[model samples]
Target chain A: MLSYLPIQLIPILPIKMNYRQAKTGKLLIDILPNKCDFCGCCVGVCPEDAIELKEAEIYIIDPRCTNCAKCIWSCPIEVIKFNKEGVLEK
Target chain B: MKEEYDIIVVGAGPAGSIAARYAAQNGAFVLVLEKDRDVGYPVRCGEAISREGLEAFIKPDKRWINAEITKFGFVAPNGKKVVINLGKVEGYMLERRIFDYELAKTASVAGAEILTRAYVNDLIKENGKVAGVKFEFRGEQKQIKCKIVIGADGVESRVGRWAGLETHIDFRDMESCFQVTASNVKCDQDALFFYFGKEVAPEGYFWVFPKGKGTANIGLGVSGGVGKKRSALSYLNNNLENFFPTANILTQVAGGVPSVVALEKMAAPGIMLVGDAARQVNPLSGGGISSGMIGASIAGRLAAQSIKNNDLNYINNYHKEWKKLRGKKHDFLDKIKDGLFNFTDEQFNNLIESMLKLPEKKRTVGRFFMIALKNKPSLLKEIAKVFVV
Candidate 1:
C-alpha cells in the first residue's frame, strides 16, 4: 500500500541588494561592464538626462543626478552602481 | 516646418508659462504648449496663497483674485474654534481658471509662442542626447528642435519620466483631495477655515476657502492610507455638507497632492523638471503655484544661460541653486508633515485642547506649531533622527 505525501513548494527568490547600501546610494560597482544593454529602459525612465547610453554603453553624464534610485530600480540587469568615485567597483 | 525655439516648455500651467515668460524675457526663443483645448479650463486647486509668496515674483493683477483673506479659523473635532488675526500675513482666494490662462498670455506677450491643444508624445534624440520633441498639434505630429526642454507638467507629469528621471511617489505620501465651489455657506468670506478631526478627515484636514459672500471652495484632503475604504470626495460629502447645510454645490474636482518629501533630484542633462512634475509642492500644505512659478523663473534663466555658454551641465547647477534657495524650508515642512500625519486621533485631540487653552491673541498657526514642538520634543527629535539614519 502506497501512502500519499504532501509536497512542499519553495518559492524562487530574486537577487536582493542591501537596503542600507541602496538607501545611501552605495552599491557594488564592479558588476557592470563598459557596454549597456541598449534596452533604453533608463533613458525612458529618467526625469533628467542623468543617464545616457551611447554605443551600447550607459554613462552618468551629469554629476547633478539626484540619485532618485529610479535607474537602479528599473535596470533589468542591475548593472548600474552608485559609488562616490562613480562606478569604481565595475 | 515651423519655427524652432531655444527652449520648449511643455504644459501651459503656472510653471510652464512662467518658464516661457522668463526664457523669452531673456531673448531665448520660447514655445509653450498646452494639451487642453483651453488654458485652465477645469480648475483643480483650493486657490489659496500667501500674498508675500506672490509678491516675491510679481504684483498679482486684481483680475485674478476672488477675495482677500485677513483672518484664519482653526476648528477642532468637538467644534472648539481658534481665531488667528492676519496681522502682516495677507492672503487671497483666486479664480485659478482665469489666473492660469492669464499667466500664459503674459508669456505670449513676452514673445513666447503659446500653442493650445498641442500634445507632445516623445523626445527627439540625436547622438543619444535630447535634441527636440515630437508632438501632435491639431492632430498633426511634428518635430520641433530645441536647445533645452523644461517640463512644467503639473502633478501627473509624463515628461519627466520620459526623460529618464524617476518621478515615482509612494501612495502613503499622497493626499487624495476633492473640492466644490459651494454657495450659501455660513462663514466669513475674509477668513479661511481649517477643520481637524479623524472622523472628518483621517490624516488630513477639511478646508473652507471663501471666494466671496456666501461662496467658497469647500474641500478636503485625506491621507492616502485613510482613503482605503472610501475616496476623499465621499469623506468630504459625508462631513462638510452637514457643517454648511444651506450651501449649494456649484463645481466639483478630484485630484491628488504630494505630501511626501521632495524629490532628491530635479534636473538631468538637457532636461529640467519644475512644478508638480518635480514634486516641488509644499509637503505640509500641498501648495505649488507660487513655488512652481518661482522655480520656473530660476530654471528658465539658468537654462538660457547654460545654452548660451554651451554648458550641458546647467541642469545640475539649476538643481543646486533651487535647493540652496528653498531646500531648508521644504525640509522643515516635510518634518512637520511626517509628524502631523503620524499623530493619532487622541494625539490630535490633545494638540487641539492645548491650543484651545492658549490665549486668543496667541493662537496663531505659527504659535501653535511652536507650542506643539515645545510640548512634544520627540517630533523634532524624530526629524533629527532622520538625518542620522
Candidate 2:
C-alpha cells in the first residue's frame, strides 16, 4: 500500500545542473584584454557561436557558450582561458 | 541606404570586391557592405601572392607592391638554408592597406555601390530562401533587399553560418597564426623564407616575407588542436630575436587560416560563399588571395547570370566550376601537405642538406619537391596518382 502511493505526492528537489556547472562551478571563460589582438580566430572556431568581435571588444556571450574550450584552443596568443578565481589556466 | 539591389556582397575584402566588380560588370545592380572603418585596416594576412595570380585581376601597381619576390628560401631546424632563384620576379608581397582599397575602388568603377563601416548582422529570408540583409551603419539599423547574397567575409565569417552553410572546420585543419610588420628588419629583400621544425612552428612553418627597404612581415602558423603547451605568438616571440635581432615591431596581428581543400557545401539557393568564407585556401601553402579572387569572380558572374536567367541552376554551377578550376589541385596538395609536414626535425635537416648535392641550375622548385618526396613512398604514391595518369 505504501509503494502504491501517488508519485506526485512525493516532493522531489529539482536537480538542475548544466554540464559546465557540473564540472567546475568556476568555469568562467574570458579574454585577457591586453593580450587579445582582436583577430577573429576565436569567432571562427566557436561551435556554439558564443564569441563576438565588436569594433575593438570581444564578448563571450554567457548563455550561448557551452564552455567547450574550442575558443581557448583557437587563440594564437593564449588570451582566452578559463578563469578560476582570478587565476587563469587551461 | 538603398532599399533593393540585384546582388549584395559582404565584407569588402578581395573576394567581396572582386565579386561585386564582376556582378556589376555583368549588369547586376550590386552593393558591397564593409564592416571596417576603412577597407583593409588592421591587416591579418601574410600578404604574399604569385606573379601570375596578381596579374590575373589587375595590373601590378608600384604604389601597392611592397616587394617583388624573385627567390625562395627554406630553413631547416639545423639552420641550413636552401635558396631557389626564380631568375625573375614571380611573386609580390603587397601593401594590403592600399591594395584592398584599390580593389574596392575597382569594384566601384565597375558600377557597384560600396558602403564602409556597415556591419551585416542578419540575413533576410523570404519563402525559406535568403533574399536580403540587415545591417548596422552609423548607429542605425538598416535593411536592404537583394536577389543574391555573396558571403566573401573572411575566415571568421558569420554570413556563411547565417545562410545555413556548414563552414565550421576541424581544428587540425585551421592554422592558428600570428604575424607582425616590422621595420629595420634584417632579411632578404627579394626572397621569401620559410622556417620549418617542431620547435619552431609545430606542425606548421614560419615565414619571413620581405616588404622591401628593411621592412618585412615575419609570421608563423601552427596547426590547431595539437594542444601545444605554448601559443603561436609565444613561440614567435621566443624565437623572433634569433631571426631578427634588431627588428623594430610596428604592427602585430593574430588570426586563423583555414587550411582545408574546400568546404563540403559553399552555396545555397540565393546565396554563395567565396574566399576564406568557403575555406578556399590552399592546404599546403595556406595562401588564399588569388584563389579567393578567382572564386569570387566565378561566384559574382554566376550570381548575375542566375538572376538574369531566372534559374537557380546557374548559381550552383559556381561550386562545380570552382572545383574544376582550383579544387582538384587543392585536393592533391592537401594530401602532399599532410605527408610533407609530418617529417621529423632530423628528416627536415637531411632534406635541406640533400638539396645541396644538386647543381645550382638543377635545384629548381620541381627538383626540390621531387627529392623531398623520394624518402616517403606514401607521398610518392600520392604524386603518382596525379602525374602517372
Top of the candidates by lDDT? 2
Local distance difference test values of all predictions, in order: 0.73, 0.85
Quality of model 2 by C-alpha lDDT: 0.85
How do the residues B1-389 of candidate 1 rate in per-residue lDDT, one tens digit apiece?
35677899988988898898988887788888777778886777889988977777667777888888889887777787777886754988888998888888888899899888777778877775677888877668888998889988666566766777778666566676778899888788888888887788777889999888689998888765665455676778887656987788899866667676557777766688888777888888888888888789888888888877778776678777777676667887888877777666666667778878887777778886776566567887876765564
Q: Candidate 2 on B1-389: residue-level lDDT in tens?
A: 46899999998989999999999998999999988888988888999999998999999999999999989999999999999999999999999999999999999999999998888888999987899999888999989999899999888888888888888777778789999999998888999999999888878899999998999999998877653466888879867877788899999988889888888888998899999999989888999999999999999999998888988668988888998899888888887788877899998898899998778887787777777788688887886786544
TM-score of each: 0.79, 0.91
Off by over 4 Å in 2: A1-27, A84-90, B382-389
Best by TM-score: 2
With a 3 Å backbone cut-off (N, CA, C), the pairs that clash in candidate 2 are none
True lDDT of residue B39, candidate 2: 92
Q: After best superposition, candidate 2 residue A36: deviation in angstroms?
A: 2.2
